[model samples]
Target chain A: MTSAPVYLVDDDEAVRSAFSLLLGTYGISIETFGDPAAFLARAPKLKPGVLVLDLRMPAITGLQLHERLAAIGCDWPTIICTGHGDVHACRRAFKAGVVDFLTKPIDEQVLVEALQQACAALDMRAERAEAAHLVAQLTEREREVLDMVGRGWSTREIAESLHLSPRTVDTHRANIAQKLGTTSVAEFARLALIGKAP
Target chain B: MIAAPSFEPASPRMPRRLAFLRSSAALAGGWLLLVAAFGLYAAETHRRALEQEVSESGRALQRAISQRVAQHDAHLTSLSALGLAQAQPSADFDLVARSILRFYPRIVAIDLVRLGPGGGVVSSARAAGGTTADPAAVSAAVKNLAAGRAVYGADARPGHYRLMKRMNDTMAVSLDIDGRGLVEEDELPGWARLDLSSAEGPLLEIGARQAVPPFAARTVEFAAPIASETQPLRLSLHRTVTLSQLVPPLPLALFAALSLAALVLVRSLLAHRREAALARAAAEAASRREALRQHETKLAHALRVNSMGEMASGIAHELTQPLTALLSQSQAGRRIAATGGLAGSPVDEVLAANVLQAKRAADILVRLRAYVGKSAGEAGMHDLRTSVSDIAALSRIDLGRRGIALDLDLPEAPVAARVDPVEIEQVIHNLIRNAADAVEETGRGDGRVVVTLTRAAEGAVITVGDNGAGIPPDILPRLFEPFFSGKPEGMGLGLSLCESIVERFDGGISAENGPSGGALFTVRLPAAGAIDEAKEAVQ
Candidate 1:
């Protein structure tokens, strides 16, 4: 499982140095770039990540970079940092892909909180990807009978579609749940995203 | 800026044109009268002299002819008797001719033509000199004589005295006559003097024949047949008269006329020269005035700039504070942004509000451009109170910084007057600054200046009140004089030139000790054009 890479970009050296230092306290290893171009050059590594960006810079604003990142399928979580105005550019960064925006003269606590959310999002995506991999493994007959039971099919409908007896179909569903390591057929059906994800 | 010259005359400044026009009219009238009168007087004298000349010449000629004939008759009568008595005609003929020659001083010739047995005898002529005359003049006289009338004519040659005369219808006889060139210039009453008179321009003039006429005081000529009806003989006399002799007043008239003409011309020339000198002087004075005005303007401008320079540090502080706040707010926002989108966050509101604050910070910069723009004379009607308030606003912080107290007693209504707002503001500000400096010098907490405005009979009155030590007694009278400053830092012309401009507007300004123990400057403008005074109907 892979956690997303978070991009942090800023213009001012002191602000960038100190801001990244505060973000480091949240235990999130941010891929820092001093400018948008440095950030954009690495954007192709779209293994889902959070982007922490500065709204204002000499070349290629944070909003524009958000657009560039979004174009490259790099949308994960984006955060905008600004030293002066919480301007249209900052709002625009959020709309482009940024999850949140912050102004400079920052409180160290806020930076830690924002970075923690972004890292947690990355952890959730990794867990979800491992779970999806585990769900990909199943026997074909067990999967068909499990599909019929997961659809809330009655024992008579399963006998008509599969040309099997209703009692036999029910036994196969029970085996399916056991193989899937859920004690109840209901839990199996819920784990299988059965009955329209109810 | 072209305007009609104001009809209101300045008290001490006289108009040049009225003076010049008066002088020119007087000069031109005098010149025309003098020339005309002079020419008329000259012509009148010439006419009278010519008339007198003609009359006297006729009488003198008649007298001389009668006298010469009488003398000739006596001699000829005796000689005729002697010749008739003698046997040989040639024997005593020399005596007869000699007798005739005895009066040669007057006589020119003796001649005889006798009639004998053949219808006429041989005619013979004798003379002291040649006896030829102009055939035409002589023939005309002879023709008149043939009709039995005595005839005579004036001399035909110039610078010489001669005459032609004829008598007709008489028997042949011996006669005596004067020839054309027989009268010598030395024999005449005045021959040499005549030439001198000619040199002084012509006295007698004849338009026809273009001949130089002989001078004549008196002339006489006579013609008659000599004891006969067929033969002719004539006698003549002439005396010349000078111009001085004819009219004694000639010199006086000419002298008076020429002197008058000379006087007119000289006076006009002198007047023109004097006017030119005056014009040059006026131009020089105007040029000097313009130069002084420009210099004062420059001084006022520099003072304003220096006053603004004192505000430079404050302006920077005013600008920098907002920018710093904006930058700090932005940095804090960036730090806060590290967190995820707030759930019903108060931070979003702070971010939006900070953006509005940043724009306010930039507005201070826009207002600074006004002070940096060009300052020029733009005089118009302005509210004095408003201008004063503006100036006070400029100095408010400085006064506070210096711990100076300012007192304002402005009128409730608009106190309007014509002025250059910028320039007037500069003047008031400079005055206030000076007052502040004065108060600062004394280092007293009680220092105060009162600015007061009131409408009086003269017009609007403005006073800048100060409680510092008053001007020295010696400097009071010349306080507004140029280059005379009471302060050590003063270059002086400020008050002096200000007074000039005020006076130009027909206003008066003065300084005196206030009743409150301070120096007060009071400026009074004429109520004529001031709206401040126009509001008097209310009160």
Candidate 2:
């Protein structure tokens, strides 16, 4: 799989440039913006990325930007950085669903580690979205068969409950396996849970 | 900060001086009036005594003159009886007449005359140096003579008078008497004039006439008639009273001296009382000035503390950006080196960037130091105990109003340090205010702020602690950093400014959780003598 994209937003040009250069040495390419407004304007069109945002910005703080993005359903993994880190701000960032909080002169290793973690969380969310999308394409009868199977129901019980013959239940199960690419009950149960998540 | 109280002493000096002069003048006037009254009374008494003496002397002299005139009548009677008994001109009558004349010196001549057809001297006698009697005087005396009545005629010569008595109608006796013999010379005082006069005019005058001055106060005159019926003489005595006698010099001098002394004594007492009042006013003014000076000192300290917070916060915000850039750049350089990047490649550019950022941050710090640092004031030796306690006392009222209790624990002996007193007070006040805020945050009724001053081997130590929640261990390390605040609305530079001011004076400050689980801040400053010793050692 391709590496996750990274975006950095900060008001200070020098700080943004320095952070971009530092992270570039570790083979992480960063797209930088001088203000939150610029980053917010391009946020919806951009691909899913790890957002490196400065907490204190001119019109919009990192937390506020995070909230605005979440309102528009652009829930990208975010890491917050501040020149002056306070506990209250840290707690607020965490409560706002930011992936990590860092203070400036941020340790390069620590930033890289936090970025790696955020990338892993993005990958996990992408896999979950892909599973949910695949589940959305299944037929209504197949969904019902899948739901029962996930509940640990037997084919005979499911056929009896649905007023279907055992051969037809077998046919619907085969269609479910072909569409989901997972015939294991545990994989079916995980896919069912993923589809059920809000 | 509190405004100074107003106190102005009324100016009583001019009015008091006027009052003193008024009272003194009144006293002096009253004294003079009393002296004048006494002088008049004494002069009146002297005048009365002098009049009494003159009248008594005049009466005595008049009685003596009357008796002398009556003796002439007796001489005339004896001469007439001798002539009448003889019945004719006989040598025996002549002999008796001459004897009468010789016996009475005032009786200068004696005569017995017959009247009606031809009245001639039947018997006559003359003194040895007496003037001869005039026939017209004899005739006039015979016409006026009455039975058993002696009549005095006018002056025969200059000072002689005649007295006649009629035995019968035709036979009468007459005698010539000298009026000058009626009075003695030494009977009158030198200041008096005495004159004896008959019905016609003045007879004889005795005593020298007194010269009356124009301004004489009074004149005394005594006049009386002689006792004898024949010779009705008037005796008059005159005396003039002078101004000097009315008011004597000796008593006036004494009274003037007494009044002056009394005035001087009263004036001195008034002056003493005025001086005491002035001294009291001066003392009050001095105390007021000192109170005003203290109030100004407190106000200055409050202003310095507030401005220091503002300046420090601004500097902190400005310095943060460059410091962040420096950290990132250096880390970038380190990463490139660890990856074995070529030294002459991007490493040089990264290193140059790091140096640039470092220099930028250092320049910002230099500007901040100049803004709120050592140039603000000079340090001086001060007792930490007094300095801490003074600020504590000033804040106590405000703390008390907010339902907080502040306690002080200062050593009895002085803890001296070389630091600016105003700067030190500012630090103490800031810490106390922070402690009060912390205690108030707990919302406990029994909020207490304790300030303690003590001397340690290192230096003078001052500790300010509160009975509130202790500082969290996580934030303790960053507590003194500029713009790092636990409070929401704080500029977050009070503690940092305190550190700067304290460190400028060669002092150190630390924060810890006390035994009671409350935040405690301790400041240590080098003692004045200790600093001197260190300087000597360094030299």
Model 1 segments more than 4 A misplaced: A1-198, B1-231, B235-237, B246-254, B257-265, B268-288, B291-299, B302-314, B317-322, B325-539
- List runs of model 2 lying over 4 Å from the truth: A1-198, B1-42, B73-83, B88-104, B214-218, B248-539
Q: What's the TM for chain B in candidate 2?
A: 0.47
Candidate 2 structure quality by residue, lDDT tens digits, A1-198: 238889998888888888887888877878899868777888899888888888766445688899998887779899998754444466657767898998665656687889999999998899899888988989888889989999999999999999999899999999999999978999988888787537
lDDT of 1 at B529: 63
Give the alpha carbon lDDT tens digit for every residue of B1-539 in model 1. Answer: 11212223233333464343336576566656665575566656765665555445434543543455445545555544554544234546665665556646445444332322232212333554424344444454445443222233333333222232222232223443443223344333322121101222322221122222455333222222223212122322223344344434556567666766776666666667667777777677676556546645665675556335324323432343335345445545644563665523677566656655655554444344234323325457777776676566555446868988777777788777676666566666666776777777778898887677777765778778788876667777667644567888876656644553454344556777777666777776555465344334223
Q: Write down the lDDT of every candidate, Cα atoms only.
A: 0.53, 0.76
TM-score of each: 0.26, 0.37
Please give the range of 10 consecutive residues that has the lowest summed lDDT in model 1 chain B. Answer: B191-200
- For candidate 2, the TM-score is 0.37
